[model samples]
Target: MNEEKNKGGMMSVIAALGANVLVAISKFIGFAISGSAAMLNESIHSIVDCGNEILLLVGNKQAAAKVSDKHPFGQARAKYFYSLVVAMMLFFAGGALGVMEATEKLFHPEHNVENTWLVMGILVFGLIVETVSLRVAIKEIKALNKDGLSLYRFLRESRHSEILIIFAEDSCAVLGLLIALGGTLLSHFTNNPF
Candidate 1:
């Protein structure tokens, strides 16, 4: 049963990783075409999410390695360490980049969004993809949660680190897409990048 749960978690992570990679590429293309700082920030966020998923997969695999005499308790702690790295990347890549770009755009007041419709379409598509990924992660979490806890409680107390990471990433991706869409629209209408 535990192995099955782990497999489900791994599948969720892989699904999210695939979605993030595609979304990142699309967002980068949108940034190139529109020159929207929000689009660029979102592209960076998706790239960081891809990296986080890869790290989680690696940590999960390492944590599952066979125990040896040199290490009696196994390497389960590796997942925690990698989770820490993911948090740091989120701070630097997602949070810091968004802040820096927003600041620059605010000060510069340059709006170069040529194809607003294309940028909006790409952001909407990204939202759909991220929603699907989030659903997959939530389904996996439901399968693992035998305690019948509330979703929030389960998220807060669950021991499944991979699922938690996937859920958080997908949620943030969706929110970031929405923010990007709003910023794109605002910039298109106001003629300012802020």
Candidate 2:
């Protein structure tokens, strides 16, 4: 049963990772076409998410290694360490960069965002992809959760780090996409990057 649960969690992570990579690529293209700071920030966020997912997978693999003479209790702590690294990357690469970009746009406010429709389309598509990924993670979490707890409670108390991470990442991605769409639309009508 534990193994089955682990498999489900791994599948969720894989699904989110794949979706993030594709979304990152699309966001990059949109950024190139429209030169929108929001698109650029979102692209950076998706790229960071891709890296985070890879780190999680590596951490899980390392944690699963058998105990050795040098470390009798095994390397299960690797997962925690990697989770910390992922958090830092999300802060610096995603959150910090986003703030910096938005601040720059506010100061300059001279960007002419061409291809607005393209950026909007990409944002909508990203939202759909992120929603699907979130659904997959939620489904796996529900399957593993046998205590009949509420979704919020389960997320708060769950020990499955991979699924939790994916859920959080996908949730943020969806929110970011919506924000990007709003920013793009606002900039388009206002004719200012801010």
Give Cα-based local distance difference scores for all models.
Answer: 0.82, 0.82
Among all windows of 10 consecutive residues in model 1, the one with the lowest summed lDDT is 1-10
Q: Give one digit per residue, the lDDT tens place, for model 2 in 96-118.
A: 77788778867876666778889
Q: How close is candidate 2 to the true structure, as a TM-score?
A: 0.87
Candidate 1 lDDT for residue 154 = 91
Stretches of candidate 1 exceeding 4 Å from the true structure: 31-41, 189-194
TM-score of each: 0.87, 0.87
Which pairs of residues have clashing backbones in candidate 1? none
lDDT of 1 at 65: 73
